[model samples]
Target: MRRAIYTGIEAFGSILEGNPKKNVIALPILQEVSDLPCDTGSELKDLQIEIEQKDLPVDLRFVEENWSEKSGKYEPTSEKIRDRAREARCWLKERPESEIVVVSHGGFLHFLTDDWEDGHKFEGIRQSHHL
Candidate 1:
């Protein structure tokens, strides 16, 4: 599959301070952002609950690999990040679309885009997660 990389976030915690409902300028290409988490504290779940209270159009869909209420990375220890990527690819392939926007955490993007690797063009992204 062909792909092009894009920039959006600075620090993971910054997303928490952001308001996706009225602050669409920060997030584009989609009215929704898939809260990319591997069961980690993306802080999006708490926000989701809060957003639901007000009834906003900014859709926040949590992918199974990236959401946890207990805390810590809530992902399966056995599941490699690539596995999630494969599943996502298959799922997207089924849905025909000319353009798709995938909103994810830095950790997920680091591994998925493999942009953190030396010589990678997107090495400009801040490396907050080691692995």
Candidate 2:
């Protein structure tokens, strides 16, 4: 998680080189809304601190819902993933920013973009599907 967070910060830094006020938002890795037992908010909180310490000219925001994964163990279904993805897509469309940078995990990203064509090729360690 630490490595991922650092790598994300580095990537964000690179993006900032071209545009300092690039709108940035992140999908919760494991937030309060998640049904998962463990949460990654602490690590993300640390990420927020690091962003501040580095003096990066951007405000990182999070989606209220944990749309990254299924709600809980019992509600395991692809339908839910699709619904959440649609919800996320709609929320993004409502944002005022003309160009927003969304930081998210690969699996959920697949759903968010409604693209499942590259499933086989992106198997294992493929964490990004570029927009």
Candidate 3:
């Protein structure tokens, strides 16, 4: 059984700060490439920088999703989110018994999980929790 750690963007810093593990993975939106103010890139970059500065022992990897030109959206359900879900499912299939930590936007996190339903919303990052 693979344990997943889903968390929003802003809290990634504090979460990594507290957790000293070396096997964490970060999932970022592929189509949405720019690090805009409230986008995934910004948050991921922030966490990356923090990790570098703090010299934490966590290993980070990103999962990329294809973008849809017809929809003109980064994470439309049928396109980006679904692709990410497939990728995660495939990864889980190969390694079905690993604990993975994912730092990404709330919507993407929900899309990756089996328990989350549509229309679910998560507030922006507030505080980070330690493992």
Candidate 4:
């Protein structure tokens, strides 16, 4: 039983340490429809503090894409997503040894993977596949 406990503890430790803690680039989403009710600026500030506490870098940017008020939905234009991916790809490419955390909307993440959809479906941005 003691041996089993030790093994379990070791496994948990490995799981925690295996993943590299590094920079995270957050993607901007609609504040009105986000999970958090707080403003984007406040959220960003909080996220920055969390990243700092975790000994990681917080590198974030807002996509320059604007949606039409009349349409009441995001346009099918890939420019914004493309721009975000470009930035992420550049950072990842430069530092092949480091791990990056991208905090963005589900749609933006999908765009990074080149799999855009009308609905909010998450297929996850697999690091290995993209890098």
Candidate 5:
């Protein structure tokens, strides 16, 4: 999560440097991590602190449960994943931001982005959880 935030800041800082009118909003999905002891609530709080300390213009939106992990213990079927992805895509399309940066686990990244051509792209995403 930290890496993704840092990357987003670094990646977009320059492009948005001189544009005061532009806005950057972060919508971290409300995901459940079964592998981890706790959930992402604390992480989001910490992230909020970091953003405040930096005085970033990022507007932290509500926790989006739509993109959360699989509902059951077992892994979701491919069709289910696709359905979730489609639903996520629909939700995202309604957002006001012109550009959005998503930072999520490996299992959901491809599904969210619909970029299955390059499997290696998601190699760095954590493997502790799956969608």
Candidate 6:
């Protein structure tokens, strides 16, 4: 029963609830609806634990390979993300039934989606997926 209380609002969130109606997935840095970016390294660590506990067959696309610890953000020109998107596109063309979900920090998300909306501070971005 992992729980979190976001400080500013003094709000509480139950980290994980049992047997969500649909597929439940976590993208460490990429909390789809979170207004704030994830703290460094925590999302990755949490995902590792989730994957291990669930025995999920997730195909991680080398998110950590070129990441910089000091910079605390993905490379501005993310060749890897672009490359993976291309690869996934190619794969999807081969098999349309398959779906690919990318989980990443806001910094990386910016590179991937060209969406740098000032950390989505106000009127946060919304998506079809939730983590």
By lDDT, the best candidate is 5
Pairs clashing in candidate 5? none
* Tens-place lDDT digits, model 1, residues 2-103: 011113222222452455432212111111112233222434555456546754334344323234432233332213454555555666567565555565
lDDT of 4 by residue, 34-95 (tens): 22223123444555465567654334444223321212233233443365466656655786
Candidate 3 off by > 4 Å: 1-21, 29-36, 43-48, 61-77, 101-104, 114-131
Total backbone clashes of candidate 5, pairs 3 or more residues apart or in separate chains: 0
Q: Which 10 consecutive residues of model 1 have the lowest summed lDDT?
A: 24-33
Query: Relative to the true structure, how large is the alpha-carbon lDDT of every model?
Result: 0.37, 0.50, 0.44, 0.39, 0.53, 0.37
The TM-score, computed over Cα atoms with residue i paired to residue i, of candidate 4 is 0.37
- Relative to the true structure, candidate 6 reaches a TM of 0.29
TM-score of each: 0.42, 0.52, 0.46, 0.37, 0.56, 0.29
Runs in model 5 with CA error above 4 Å?
18-21, 30-42, 64-84, 97-106, 118-131
Arranged by lDDT, best first: 5, 2, 3, 4, 1, 6
Q: Give one clash count per candidate, in the order shown.
A: 3, 0, 0, 1, 0, 0
Error of 1 at 65 (Å): 12
Model 2 poorest 10 in a row by lDDT: 30-39
What is candidate 4's CA lDDT for residue 108?
51
Error of 5 at 18 (Å): 5.1
Tens digits of per-residue lDDT for model 3, 49-116: 77688565444555223222313344343444566566766766676546644544444555566456
- Residue-level lDDT of model 2, residues 5-42, one tens digit each, is 45466777676566755634454431222234332344
Stretches of model 4 off by over 4 angstroms after superposition: 1-14, 18-44, 48-78, 98-105, 117-131
Q: Write the residue-wise lDDT of candidate 5 on 84-120 in tens digits.
A: 5666677778978887666555655676676777555
Instruction: Give the CA lDDT, 0 to 100, for residue 10 in model 6.
Output: 23
Model 6 C-alpha lDDT per residue in residues 66-111, reported as the tens digit of each score: 2323233322224444443445445446754355444344444554
Q: Any residue pairs clashing in model 4, and if so which?
A: 27-103
